[model samples]
Structures are given as C-alpha cells and as structure tokens.
Target chain A: MHLYDSTIPSGNAYKVQLLLSHLHIPYAITSLNILATPPETRSSDFLAINPNGRIPVFILDDGTPLIESNAIMFYLAEGTPYLPDDKLAKAQVLQWLFFEQYSHEPYVAVWKFRTYWALNGFEDLSGREIQKLKERGQAAIDVMERHLEGREWFVGTNYSIADIALFAYTSAAEQIGFSVGPNVKAWLSRVEGTKGWVKIKKDETGKCPL
Target chain B: MHLYDSTIPSGNAYKVQLLLSHLHIPYAITSLNILATPPETRSSDFLAINPNGRIPVFILDDGTPLIESNAIMFYLAEGTPYLPDDKLAKAQVLQWLFFEQYSHEPYVAVWKFRTYWALNGFEDLSGREIQKLKERGQAAIDVMERHLEGREWFVGTNYSIADIALFAYTSAAEQIGFSVGPNVKAWLSRVEGTKGWVKIKKDETGKCPL
Candidate 1:
C-alpha cells in the first residue's frame, strides 16, 4: 500500500497510521507539505489522485485509491480483532466513527490546528470563534467521558477502531486548552498501553518518519 | 423497528426512511418537534434514547438503539443490494458516506436550515455567513459533479447507500440556491427512478406523515 499523507500532525491521517501499526502492515508514504503556501493537497497533481484534495489517501496494491480516514480504518481493520464480527457491535463501532468525524473532529481537531498554527506565528481565528470551538470541543469530550463511565472501549469489551478514531483527536485535547475528564484521561493511558500502539507522530514500525 | 425522527425535514432521518422503504420494512416512528424552542431532541426523554440528542435513532427488535444516519443505513442494508458484498466496493461506499457527513452535509444542510428558518421569520445567520455557506456548499457540489461525470451511482455499478447518503442533501441543492451540474442533476433523476424510492418528507409505503 502507498499513502499520501501530511508532514504536519493530522489526526485524520494518524488514524490510518495507528491501525496499520496494530496490523503490522508496512507501506510507503509520500508526505505532502500541507502548511506550504497554497498547500500541496490543493495542487492539481494531488487533486488528480483525490478530487477532494485531502491527504491520507491510501492506495491499494491494485491501484485503487481510498479517501476518508475512518473509512480507510474500516477497510484495514476488517477480519481483525480491531473490528468485531457481531453485526450490532460492528454497527456500534461505525456509529462512534461517524460521531468522531461529524461531532468530535470538526471542533477538537480544528481547535488543535488553530492552536498549532497560532503557536507557530499564524493566528486566523478571532477570540469569539476560538471560544466557540473550545466550548463545542468540550461538549464532545464530555460525551466521551459519559460513554466511558463503565466501558473500557468505545464499542464492545475489546479495544476497537472506534476507540482509535476518537483517540486520534482526543489525545491532543489538553494541549489545546480543553480539560480532560478523569474517565477520558484514564482511557488515553489505556490506549497507549495497547500492544503495538504507535503515537500520532510515528509510523507503523515505531519510527518517526519526519 | 422503532425510529425516533424529526417532525421537520431532516436528510439524516430521511436516509433511513428511504432505505426502509426500499427494503419493505415496517417500522414505527416517534416524530419529535425539532423546530420547537429547545427542541424535543434535547429533552431528557429523547436524550435517554440517544445521548447525542440527534434524530433518526433506530431501535431494533431486541431494543438496541442505533445512532448515526449512515450507520443505521449500513445495518439495515447488510444483506440487501443497497450495500454490496465486495470488500473494496464496500469500502468505497463508506468513503462516500463519510464524505457526505463531513464535507457535504455541514455546508449544504446548514444552508438549507438557515434558509428555512429565515423564510419562516427567524433569521439567525448574517448575509456574510450565508454567502460563506453557499460557497462551501457549492464546493462540495462541485466535488460530487466531478465524481459523477460518467457514473450512474456514487460507488460501483449499482445504486448503493453511498448514492443515498449523498442524494439526501444534494437533491435539495438547487432549492437552497446552489447550482447543480449536469452529471449530478442526471444522477438525481436516476436515484429518484430507483425502485421503492421515497421523497424525503415521506415515510416508507409512500405516505406523507407530516
């Protein structure tokens, strides 16, 4: 497999990298400079590979390119313990994945991106916009905290891709100024303790490619 | 099956209604008054059904509540033609489903909601915000047009749930001031022509519940 990813930290891209590590799948990467003026993702060449012009486009050995990070994780985790066999359990996994993309990522990931950019000397969002982002991001975190009250993982008893999907962004919450509840804080530690787990900054083999 | 839906038009809930119509499944609905101040979805009773406070919560015969519109469609379409059997094709279907939620629905559906509210004497968004929504919504439509250049459906040769997911909001593009390209326009007609297809405001068996 070949992955068109970003040099910057993107939780969407990292979800795929984390799952690949769990499965021990080795693949080549082409890291695009997303922070570059005009961003490499919007270039005509990159857009040809993905019309939406987003990174983490995973190319199968057969040359078919797949976009969307959660979908890619779903594709990679098939037949593995990371994706359950029970129909309802699988659907529950997907429900969390969708929730991560629609509810969690938009606020948490965007706030983290803005904070990263601001720390690096670029501030685009106003105080009000940032405040809204923080509040909404906190709401998503609270949902996770409530869901994790008695559960170890997001879905069934086992740690599944649903956990990985939410963990990719939630792991960075505190750094972006959102308080992590005790349940979520402990769950983050549990995710890190999972066998063969890799940090967002590293590749599948525990190597920091950048 | 029992569905907790909205009294108003919701593309998210309509995806389930359309799929159930195609599958000839009989289900009961508890339509919440979402347009009411404070919205019934946020009420304690409805929140008990779905912590997310969102509609289109489908409950199975054994009483397992399913959230997320696309996830519900995936569970319902498991053995049907609406979801395919091939692994790669299935992944592609999911890719579009995620894209619809993340990229398409936010802009297009929000624009529609704002327009509906403004026409009904409640103006929440400024003109500038509305313009931004229109531009972003058009960008999503443009991506769909490029993908549908020669294809009859969003994924594979059949009319899978990928088409259904995208079609839910894209069908309303022109009504909300976004232009529909030729390819997407034709594809909408094709989706409407599918067997067991129902309008967004109608339930299964082709009755307008509202």
Candidate 2:
C-alpha cells in the first residue's frame, strides 16, 4: 500500500498515518508540495489519483485509490481492535468521524493552516474571518470537552478510530491558541499514551518525487 | 426508531428521511423550529439528547439517540441493498459521504439557506460572502458533474447512501441559481426514479411541537 500525502502537517492525512502506525502496517509515502504556487495536489497527475485534488489518498494493494481521510481510516481499521464489532458502536465511531470533518476540522484545521501560512508571508483569511475561525474552532473544542466529561474515549470504553480522528486536531488546540478544557486535555493525554503511538513529523523542506 | 428533525427542508436531515422512506421504516419525527430566534435545536432539552444540537438525530429501538445524518443512514442501511457488502465498495460509499459533508453541503446547503432566508427578510451572509458561497457551491457541483460523466450513481452499480446524501442538496441546486451540468441532471433524474423515493416537504409555517 502507498499513501499520497503532503510535507506540510495535515491532521486529515495524519489521521491515516496514525492509524497505520497503531496497526503496524507498512506503507510507502509520496509527499506533495501543497504550499507551492500551483499546489501539487491540483496537478493533473495527482488529480488522476484523486479527482478531489486532495492528499492522503491511500492506494490498496490491488491499486484501488481511496480518498477522504476518515473513510480511509474506516477502511484500514475494519475487523481490527480499533473498530468495534457491534452495530451501534461502529455507527457511533462514524458519527464522531463525520463530526470531526464537518464541525471540528473546518475550523480547527483551517485556523491552524491560516495561522501557520501567514507566518510564512501567505495570508489567506482576513481579520474578521480569522476571528470567526477562532470562535468556531473554540466551540468545536468545547463540544469535545463536554463529550469527554465522563468518558475516556469518544465512542466506547476502549480506544477506537474516533479518538484517532479527533485526536489529530484537538491535540494541537493549545498550540493554536484554542483553550482546551480539563476533560479534553486529560483525554488527549490518554490518547498519547496509547500503544504504538507516533508523532506527526514536520517536513520543513518542501520537496517531493515526481 | 424516531427521528429528531426540523420542519425546514434540511438536506442533512432529508438524507435520513429519504433513506428511511426507501427502506420502508416507519419512524416518528419531532420537528424543531430551527429558524426561530435562538433556534430550538440549541435548547437545553434538545442539547440533552444530542450535545451537538444538530437535527436528524435518530433514536434506536433501544432508545439510544444517534447524531449525524450519514451515521444514522449507515446504521439503517446495514444489511440492506443501499449499503454494499464489499469492503472496497463500502469504503467508496463512505468516501463520497465524507466528501458530501466536507466539500459539498457546506457550500450548496449554505447558499440555499442564505438565498431562501433572504427572501423572507432574514439576511445572514454579506454580498461578498454570498459570492464566495456561489463560487464554492458551483465548484462542488462541477466536481459532481465530472464524477457523474458516465456513471448512474455515486458508488458501485446501484444507488447507495452516497447517492442519497449527495442528492439531498444537489437536487435543489437549480432552484438556488447553480447550473447543473447534463451528466448531473441525468443522474438526478435517475435518483428520482428510484423506488420508494419521497420529496422533501417544505414546512413554511414555522410552528413545531415544544
């Protein structure tokens, strides 16, 4: 299997990488320069791999390419300890996964992107837009804090992909200026202590093989 | 199962309703006044059911309330024709589901909401914001158009939840001033022709059971 990813840190791509690490699956990575003038993700070659023109496209051993990070995680975690067998449990995991993509990442990840890129002299959002991102991103964090009040994991008693999905972005909240409540902070600590955990690597040099 | 939904024509909520109608599952709906001042979805009572305070919450026979429309659809579509049994096909369905929520609905549904509410003297987005919504929304539609070039459905050989999820918003694109390409239009007609299909009923009278 191979993962078409980016050099810049992406929580969405990292979700797959984290899960693959936990599962001890060996795969090759093809990093793309998404911050380039014409982002490599939008290039014809990459678009051929994923029409959506996004990274973290996982190719199966049979050469079938799958896009969407959460979906790829779902595919990878199937029949493993990371994914529960009970019907309701699987659905709950999916609920959090969708919530992460729709509510959490749009704000938290976008804020991180804008903030990080602005430091490099690329400003994408206006002042007002940044304020909205902060408010919305904090709201998403608050939701996670409340959900973690009496629970260790997002779905059930055991650690599941739901934790992996939310952990990717929520862990970076404090670094990105969003306040993390005690519950979420504790939960992040628990996620970090999980076996076979790997840190997201930063690739400062923007270079990729064609 | 009972569905906690809103009277307003919500593409997210409609995705669940359309699936239930297809499966011939009888479920009661508790419509909330989502357009009201302070929106009943954010009320303490509803919040207790779903902390996220979003509508289309599907309660199981065991009284477990499930949030997220796609998750509810996944739970209901299991062991049914709407959800495939093949692993890769299932992942493909989810890929489109995530794409719909992340890439498609935010723009198309938000554009539709702003345009519809503007007619009733409720303006939420500024002129510039509306333009951005238009461009983004049309870009989403163009992606769908390209995907539907020679395909009848979003995933696999038959109509799955992917089609249902995308159809909820894409069907209304023309009414909101977004042009639908020929391929997407034909695919929309195919979706409309599916068995057990139901139209999204618009409740203009803003009343709901407390």
Candidate 3:
C-alpha cells in the first residue's frame, strides 16, 4: 500500500500514520509539500488520484484511491482493534470522526496552520479571525476535556480511532493557544503510550515529514 | 426509537429522516424549534441530550443518545440496503459522508441558514463573509458535480447513505441560488427515486415541524 501523504505533519494524515504504526501495516509514503510552491496536492497527477485534491489519500494495493482522513483511517483500521466490532461502539468511533472533521478540525487544524505554516501565520489573521479561531478551537478542546472527564479514552474502554482522530489535533492544542485541561492533556499522553506509536516529525521546512 | 430532531428543517437531521423512511424504521419525532424564540437546542435540557447542542440527535429505544447526523444515519441504516456489504464500498460510503460534512455542508448549509433563517440572511453578512460562503459553497458543489459525472450514485453502484448525506443539502442548492448541472440534476432525481423516498418539508415558520 502507498499513502499520498503531506510533507507537513497534517493532523489528518497523522491520524492515519498513528494507526498504521499501531497496526504495523507496512506502507510507503509519498511526501508532498501540500502548502509549498505550486501545491503538489493540487497538481493534475494528484487530482487524477483524488479530484478533491487533498492529502492523506490512501491508495489501496489494487490502486483504488481513498480520500478523506477519517474515512481513510476507517478503511485502514477496519477489522482491527483500532476499530471496534460492537455496533454502537463503531458508531461512536464514527461520531468522533465526524466531530473531528466538522467541529474540531475546522477550528483547531486551521488555527494550527495559520499559527505555524502560513505566510501570515496567526499574527497575520484579522482580530476577528483570531478570536473566532481561539473561541471555536478552545470550545472543541473543552468538549474533549469534558468527554475525557472520568474516562481514559474518547470511546469505549479501549483506544480506538476516535482517540486517534481527536488526539491528532488536541495534541497540538497548546501550540494553538488552547489551554487544555488536565483531562485532555492526560488523554494525549495515553495516545502516545499506545503500541507502535510514532511521533509526528517535521522536515527542514517545519512540516510533518512523515 | 425517538429522534430528537430539529424543527428548523436542518439538512443534517433531514439525512436521518430520509434514511429512516427508506429503511421503513419506525421512529417518533420530538421536534424542537432549534431556531425558535429562545432556540431550544441551546437550552440546558437539550444540552443534556447532546453536549454539542446540535439538532438531528437520535435517541435510540434504549435511550442511548446518538449524535452527529452521519453517525446517526450510519447506525440507523446498519445492516440495511442503504448501507452496502462490501468493505471497500463501505469505505466509499464513509468517504462521501465525510465529504458531505466537511466540504458540502459548511458552505451550502450555512448559506441556506443565512439565506432564509438567520436575521440578516446573505444581505446581512459582510462582503468577506458572503464571498467566503459563496466561493466555498460553490467549490463544494463543483467537487460533487465532478464526482457525479459518469456516476449514478456516490458509492459502488447503489443509493447508499452517501447519496442521502449528499442529497440532504444539495436538494436545497437551487433555493440558495446555486445553478445545478445536468449530471447533478439527474443524480438528485435518481436519489429521489430511491426506495421509501420522502421530501424535506417546512411548516408555517419555515421549520421542519416533523
């Protein structure tokens, strides 16, 4: 299997990488500087693979192109311990996946992007944009903190993709000025303790050099 | 099953309603005026049901609270024809679900809300906000149109939840001033022809009275 991943340590792609490592699934990564000059993800070749033109696209052994980070994580982790077998538990995983994409990622991921990689960074953003980012991103982090209260994981008793999906961004919450509570902070450490865990590394450009 | 649905004709909740009708699953609707005088969705009582305080929250017969429209649709449609049996096909279903939430809904749904439901509608938004909404929404529609080209349904040769998830908002595209392409128009018609098809309707206050 091959992953059309990003040069930047995308939390979205990091979710997939964290699972593949935990599952010990061997796959090569094609690192594209998604935010670099000409934006490789927007290239015709990449668009042919995924018309949506996004990174963290997983190409199956049969060469089928699978897009969407949470969906790709679902595909890679299906039938594994990372994806539970019980029906509702799987829905719980899906629930967190949707939350990660809709509520969490939009705020947290964008904040991280503008804060670290973009030309303006967070400093370049409007006072309104900065306020919206902090409020929304911190709200997402607060939701995680509340969900993590009296629990070690996001979903059922085990560490599932829900943990991975949430952990991907929440791990970097502090950098985005999100003051995560002890609960969310503890959950992040627990994700790090998972088997076959691999930390998100950066390239010379300070991107997730997966 | 009791569906803690929205009275505001939310496209998100409409996805679940469409699926339940297709599956012939008996469900009672508890319609809350999410956009009512006080906005029932933000009340402490409603927050107790879903901490995120969003509508389209489905409460199962066992009183388990299932949040997130796609996740609830996945749960209600499990083992049914709306959900396919193949593994890769299932991932495709998930792919479109994520796409609908992340790509399609944000632009389209928010436009729909601001257009008709919000106090100012599109006219009230700043030039930047309106521009962002239109551009983002149109870009999402363009992606869907490209995907729908030469394809009847989003997933493997069937009208799955992917169709339902996409259809929920795309059905309202025209009202929001989006010009539908021939291919997307045909695809929307095909979705309408699915089994147990039910149209999304609005009551006196332009809300989904259920």
Candidate 4:
C-alpha cells in the first residue's frame, strides 16, 4: 500500500500513519508540498486518485484510492488487536475520532495554519483573526484537559483509535501556540509509552522505519 | 435506551437523534439551553453525567453516559441497517463522517455560531475577520459542492451516516449565512425527501417529533 501525505503534520494524516505503524503494515509514503501555490494536491495525477484532493490518501495494494485518514486507519486496523471488538467500545472510538475533527482539530489546526502556514507575509494576518483563533484554540484545550483528568486515554482502560486520533496534533500543541495543560500533558506521556509508537516525521524515506 | 439531547438543533447532536428515530427506539429527549450563561451543560450535575460538558451526550438505559454525537449515532446504529454490512462500504461511510468533522463542519458550524450566536457583536467583527470567514466558509461550500456533483448523497449508493452527518448542517446552511450553490441546494431537497428523514428544529417541546 502507498500513503500520500503532505509536509504539515496533520492529526488526520497521523491517524493513518500511526495505525499502520502499530499494526506493522508495510506501506510506502509520498509527500506532497501543500505550501506551494496551487498545491501539488491539485495536480491532475493526485486528483485522479482523490477527487477531494486531500492528504493521507491511501492507495491500496489493488489500487483503490481511500481518502479520509480515519477511514484509512479503520481499513488497515480492522479486526486487529488495536480495534475494539465490543460494538459499543468501537462506537466510542469513532466518537472521539469525530470529536478530534469537530471540536479538537478545528481550533488547533487553524492556530497552526495561522502561526505557520499563513505566516511569513504570504497573506496579511489581522489582529482580530489571531485573537479568535487563540480564543477558540484555548477553549478546545481546556475541554481536553478537563476530560483527561484521571483518564488514561479517551476510551475505556485502553489505547485505541481515540488515542491515535487526538494524540496526532495534541503532542505538538505547543508548535501551534497552545499548551496541552497538566493532565493532557501527562496523558501524552502515557500514549508515547505505548509499544510500537512512532512520531509524525521520523522517517528518512517516509516509510515505517520500525 | 434513553438518549439525553439538548433542545438546540446541533448538527452533531442530531446525528444520534436521527438514528434513534429511524430505528424507532424509545428514547427520552432532554432539552438543554446552551445560551444560558453558565450553560446547563457546564453545571456540576451535567458534569457528573459527562465530564466533557457538551450536549448530545447519550445515557444508555443502564445510565452509561455516551458523549460525542457521532459516537452515540454509531453506538445506536451498530449491527443495524444504518451501518453498512460490507467492510469497505462501511469504511467509506466512516470516511465521510471524518470529512464532515475535519473539513465540512468546522467552517459550516463556525459560520453558524457567528450568525446564530451573533458573535459579531459579542466580539468585534472587523472587515478583515468578516472577509476571512467568508473566504473560508465559501471554500468549504465549494468542496461540498464538488463532492456532491452527480450523487444523491455523500456516498455512492446508500444514505448512510455520511448523509446524516452532513445533512445536519448543509440543510441549515442558509440560516447560518452559507450560500448553498445550485448543486448543494438540489441535494438538500433529495436528502429531506428520504423516508426516515427529520428536520433539525421541533415545534414546541424542542423534541424530535418522530
């Protein structure tokens, strides 16, 4: 299988890469430069693979182009030890995945884009825009900190997709100009201690080094 | 199982409510007023039920509080007609759900918050901030329009969770200050015409009349 990702370490992309590493799935990675004007993702070749033109698109061994990152994670980890067998537990995992995208990622991601991608005079950044991003981002962080109190992971008594989804951007909260807080900071360490864990940009050739 | 949902027509909350309606499951709807400063969701009583302090939290018949809207939807629909039986097909559904969160909902929901909650006056909405929001919101709408071309719903054949998730907001796009293009506007009609479909708001009790 081949995974097409981008330079920015998106939580959504990291979800796919994390699952593939944990499951020890053999896959090759291709990096696209999204920062480039008319992003490489808009190229005809990439669009043929994913009409939506987003990253963490998985090209299956049979050449099926699977676009959403969580879906790629689900496809690779289905029936594996990482996925919960209990019906309700699995739904809980999906719940956090949704939360990561809805409540969590929006705030954190826009912060990162404003600070990193949208910086450097590429386009003018207004003071009001930055203020809103910071306010929204902080609100999201507060929610995560409160929820992590006394909890090992997002789900019940185990490290599941919930951990993978949230951990992707969360570990790099500071880079986005936000803090993960004490409880969530502690939870990050616990997630890192998990066996077969991998960082977002650790590979030389973008392949699973493990 | 009983479902505790707010009176507010939240897209995320409606996901769970819609599924239960489709299944004809006996459930209770608890109206929560989020506009109440120190909202009911933030109170200690609700916190004991869900530490996350968010609405659309689902409590099972046994009093297990399931937070996150999509999580509750999947939990209710698992092994039922809502979730696709085929593996890849189901993964496709999950992909759209993730897309709804990461790409679709952020811009749509924020635009809604600004318009409905009137964040413009609550905070200073400068010309620059307004322009940026419009740009971002239109980008999101364009993406949805491109994806919806020649399709009745988000996925190819069935009206799965993807439709449910996206329908929650896209249906209300205009009210939230988003312009639904010709394609998306047509698709909205098709979605509402589905057999088990329900609208976001209720007449008096703010309960889904299904």
Candidate 5:
C-alpha cells in the first residue's frame, strides 16, 4: 500500500502516518502541497484518484483509494487492539471520532490552517476567526481535558484509535497558536509515554504525502 | 432509550428518528429552536447534559449520554442491519461516515444552517464564513455529483447509514435554499423510496423525553 500525502504537515494526514508506524506496517509516501494556490490536489491527475481532492489518501493493497483520514485509520486499525472489542466501547470510540470531526477539527484544525499555513486577510483570520478559534477550540479542548482528567484514554482503558485521531493535531496545537491548559498538556504527555507511540514527522527522506 | 431531539427538521437528527421507528424502539423527542440567539443548546442545563451544546443527544437506558448525532445513530444501530457485517463492507460504511463528517456535513449542513435557519447574515455568519462555505460547500456537492453519476448508494449497493447521514441534510437542502443538481435530486428520491424511511416531521404528538 502507498499513501499520497502532503509535505506540509496536516494533523489529519499525520494520523494515518502515525498509525502505519505504530502498527509496523510498511508503506510508501508521496508528497503534495495542499497550501499551494490551486492546491496540487486540484490537478486533474490527483482528482482522478480522489474527486474530493483531499488527503491523506491511502491506496490499499488492492489499490482501493480511501480519502478521508479517519476512514483510512479505521480501515487500517479495525479488528486490532487499536479498535475496541465491546460494541459499546467501539461506539464510544466512534463518539470521539465524531467529536473530533464536528467540534475539535472544525475549530482547532481551521485555526491551525489560518495561523500556520494560510495566514492572510484573504483567508481572514482576524476578529471572528480568532474569536471562534478561541471559543469553540477551547471548548473542544475543555471537553477533552475534562474527560482526560481521570481517564488515560478517551473511550476505554486502552490506547485506541480514538486517542490517535484526537492526538494527531492536538499535540502540535501550540504551533498553531492554540493553548492546551494543564489538564490537556498532562494528557498529551501520558499519550506520548505509551509504547508503540510515534511522533508524526517527515520520514527519513524528508517527504510525505499531505 | 430517550432522545432529546427537536422538530426543527434536522436531517442529522432525522437519521436517528428514522432508524428508531424502523426498529420499533421507543424514544422521546424534545424540540428546541436551534436558531434562537445564544441557541438553547448553550444553556447551562443543556450544557450539563452535553457540553458540546448540540442537538439530537441520546440517553441510553442506563443513563449514558451520547452526543453527536452520527455517534448516537451508531449506538442505536450497532449489531443490527443498520451496520454492515462484512469487514471491508463495514469499513466502507465508516468511510462514508467520516466523509459525511469532514466533507459532507461541514458543507451541506452549513448550507442548510445559513439558508434555512435564517443564519446567513446574522453576526455568526460573518464575511469569511460565507466565503469558506460557498467555496468548500460547492466543491463538496460537486464531488458528490461526480460520485453519484451512476451509483445508487454510496457503498455496496444497499441502503446503509451512509445514505441516512447524507440524506438527512441533502433532502432538506432545498428548504435551506441550496439547489441540488438533477443527479442528487434523483439520488434523493431513490433514498426516500427505501424501506423503513420516515419523514423529518413526525406526528406532532410525538413522545417527549421527560
């Protein structure tokens, strides 16, 4: 399997890369620039593979193209220790995944996009953007922080993909100018301390698909 | 299980209501005006139940509170026909769920919010808000149109939760002032004609969560 990824770091793409490493699965990576005007993903060739023009798009062993990052994570980790055994626990996992998408990702991810990669009045990160990032983003973090106050992971007692999905962008949120209070910061360290955990970064070749 | 849902006619919430009726599971519906200023979800009481302050939160028989409409749908439908049994098929199901969250929901759902809810020019929409919605939302619909050129369902030639999730908002999209191309219109009809479907507006005397 090969992943067509973006070079510029994206938390969503990083989730897939980290999962592959954690599982010791071998794969090739290709880099694309999502920040480029008329993103490289908009190109006809890339669009042929994914009409959505997003990443990290995982081409499975049989060459099936999986576009959404969380979907790819679920595909790779299903039936493994990374996914839960109890049906309700699995539903809990999906709960967090949905939370990340609807709440955390919308606020924090876009804040990261504007503050890091696409900073400009054209994208307009002033006033309401900053306000929303602070309000909704912090609200999302508060939910996670409160949940992590006593538990080691989001769903059950183990390290599941729910943790991986939420951790991908959150660890580096400071770079995007978002704050993680004490509770979330402590949770981050706990997650990092887990075995088989890997930091999402460029490979030895200094390239990855975004 | 009792559901704190409203009759404001949300497609996301409708997915749960439809499945509950099909399964003959009794649930209570609680309606709130999500458009009201400082939306009712932000109330201290509602936040105590769901800090994320969103609607269609479900309370299980054991009093477990499940937020995120899709997560609630999964919780209700797990181990049932609503979820596929095949491994790859199930992953495909989740693939659409993730897609609905990241791509479809943000775009189509937002379009509904801005159009139907009279939220477009409100202080909430802001200038940048409309821009991102127009660009990204249109792109999302374009991708769906391309994907639906020939396929009836999103995956595996059957009516799945993916259809329910997407159909929820996509069906009511016209009321929200968004136009569905001929392809999506036909797709909507196909989904509406499926077995075990229900309209967004249930009987006025629908049970309430008390």
Candidate 6:
C-alpha cells in the first residue's frame, strides 16, 4: 500500500501515519506540499486520486484509492488492537472519530493551521472570529475531557484509532494557545505510552517534515 | 430499539429515520426539540443519553446509546443489505459518510437550516458569510455531482447508508435555491426508488412532522 503524504503538518494525515506505524505496515510516502497556494491537492492529478482534493489519500495493495483519514485508518486497524471487535464498542469508536472530524478538528485543527500560517499573528484575527474559535474549540476539548473523566481511553477500555484521531489535534491544543482540560491533558499523555506509538514530526514552520 | 428523535429538522436524524423505515426495523422515537435556542440537546437529560447532545441517539435492545448519526446507522445496518460485507466497499461507504459530515453537511445542511430558521431571512446574513456559504456549499454539491456521474449510488453498486447520508441534505438543495448537477439530481431520483424508502417528513418549522 502507498500513502500520498503532505509536506505540511496535517492532523488528518498524521492519524494515518500513527496507525500505519502501529500496524508495522511498511508503506511508501509521496510527500506533496499541499499547503502551497492553490494546494497541490487541487491539481488534476491529486483530484483524480481524491475528488475531494485532500491529503491522507491511501492507495491500497490493489492500487485502489481510499480517502478520508479515519476511514483509511479504520481499514488498516480493523483487526488490530486499535479497533474493537465488539459491535457496539466499534460503533462508539466511530462516534468519537466522527466527533473529531466534525466538532473537534473543524475548530481546533483549523485554528492551529490558520494561526500557524497567519502572516500577522493571532492579533490580526478579528476579535469575534478568534473568540468563536476559542469557545467552540474549547467546547470540543471539554467534551473529550468529560468523556475521559472516569475512563482511560475513548472507547470501552483500550486505546483505539479513536485515540489517534483526536490525539492528532488535541495534543497540539496547547501549542496553539487553546487551553485543554486536565483530563484531556492526562489522556494525551496516556496515548503517548501506547505500544508502537509514534510522534508527529514538524519543522520550524510548525508543519510536517518535508 | 429506541431513537431519541428531534422535533426540528435535522438532516443527521433524518438519515437514521430513512434507514430504519427501509430496513423495516420496528423502533420507537422519543422526539425532543433540539433546535431550540440553547438547544434542548444541551439539557442535562439529553446529555445523559448523548454527551454530544445531538438527536438520533439510538438505544440498542440492551439500552446502550449509540451517538453520531452515521455511527448509529452503520451499527444498525451491520449484518444487513444496506451495509456491505466486503472490506473495501465498506470503507468506501464510510468515506462518503465522512465526506457528507465534514464537507457536505457543514455547508449545505447548515445553510439550509440557518436560512430556514433565520427569523428575518437569509438576507439577514452578512454578505461575506453568505458568499462563503454559497461557494463552499456549492463546491461540496459539485463533488457529489462528479461522483454521481455514470453512477447510480454513492458507493459500489448498491444504495448503502452513503446514499441516505447525502440524500438527507442533497435532496433539500433545490428547496434552498441551490443548483445541483444533472447527474446528482438523477441520482437523487434513483435513491427515492430504492425499496422500502421513506420520505423525510416535516412540520411548519421546515422540520419533521409530529
């Protein structure tokens, strides 16, 4: 299998990398600077691979294209310890994954990316926009914190892709000046201790290694 | 099984309803007005069932709550015809569901909801916000159009949950003055023809009926 990687930091893409490393899947990476203006993701070539024009597009062993970071990771971790075999437990894992994409990433991840690339720094952001991002992003983080209050992992009892999915961005919360609750912070650390865990690398631009 | 249905129009909730009716799974709905300001979803009682406080929270026969609309549908559709057994095809269904949540619903569904619920009118929206919504929402619709080209369903050869996920909102595009490509319109027509398909009903609030 081959994964089209992004040269810039991407939590969505990172989710795939973490799972691949955990599964001991030795695959190839073709890094593209998707962050560049008119992102390479928009090119016809990338578009042909993923009409959505996004990164973390995985090419299966059969050479078929699979997009969506969570979907790709779920495929890879299906039989691994990262994905539960129990049906309802499996669905709960999915619930968090969807929450990560819809509630968490949209606010937290976008804020991290835009603020990292912001030419004029956080002060340049409109007060209202900044406040909204802070409030909403914090709300998402709060949800995770509350969920982790009496639990160690997002799912039943083990670490799953649900952890990797949210860990990608939630781990970066403090770096972006977004305050994370204590429970989330502690859970983030627990994720780091998981077997086969790999760190997300980035350069001075606060982005993925090129 | 019981589903905590929402009284107001929710494309997410509608996806579950359409599927249950199609699957002929006899279940009960406890409608709550989640669209109310400080949404009823935020109430302590609703939060007990779903920490996310969203509707379409499905309770299994054992009384376990499954949140996330797509997750609930996926759970219910398991071992059924609506969800494929093939590995890769299942991922494809999930990819589109994520696409619907991340790309499509954020813009298309939100636009339809805000515009429909806007006390004044869509005209009351800020010019820049409106423009952004139109462009992003249309881009999502365009992706679906391209995918539907020469295809009858969103995934493989069958009408899976992917079709229901996108159909809940894509079908409402025209009602909001959004233009959909011919192929997308044709596919929408095809979805309606699926066996046991049920229409999403609504009351005067542009939402599901009582």
Report the lDDT tens digits of candidate 3 across residue range B64-165: 999999999898778988899788899999998998899889998998887777875676456877788888888888888888888998887888999999
lDDT of 5 by residue, A81-196 (tens): 89887878888888888889888988887766655556372254567667877788878888888778778788878988899899987886766667687877887887788777
Give a tens-digit lDDT track for model 2, residues B171-201: 9899778999999999989988999999887
| Model 4: DockQ score | 0.61
The CA lDDT at B179 in model 1 is: 93
lDDT of 2 at A158: 95
Tens digits of per-residue lDDT, candidate 6, B45-121, equal 88988777777798889888889999999998999999999989999999999999999898888787776665555
Estimate the TM-score of every prediction.
0.93, 0.94, 0.95, 0.86, 0.90, 0.95
- The candidates, ranked best first by lDDT, are 1, 2, 6, 3, 5, 4
Q: What is each candidate's DockQ, to 2 decimals?
A: 0.84, 0.87, 0.87, 0.61, 0.69, 0.84
Which candidate order results from sorting by TM-score in descending order?
3, 6, 2, 1, 5, 4
Summarize candidate 4's per-residue lDDT along A1-210 as a digit string, tens digits. Answer: 898988765667778888888888888989897767889998989987776678989988888788787777777777886778888788777877776777767767766655555536325656766666677777777877887888888778888877888888777787656866899888889888888898777533332222
- Per-residue error at A14 for model 5, in Å? 1.1
The lowest-lDDT stretch of 10 consecutive residues in candidate 4 chain B is B201-210
Docking class of 6: high
True-structure lDDT of candidate 2: 0.87
- Residue ranges of candidate 3 with Cα displaced over 4 Å: A123-125, A207-210, B36-38, B206-210
lDDT of 3 by residue, A71-107 (tens): 9989888888899988999998999899889998999
lDDT minimum window of 10 residues, candidate 4 chain A: A201-210
Native A-B interface contacts kept, per candidate: 0.89, 0.92, 0.87, 0.79, 0.79, 0.79
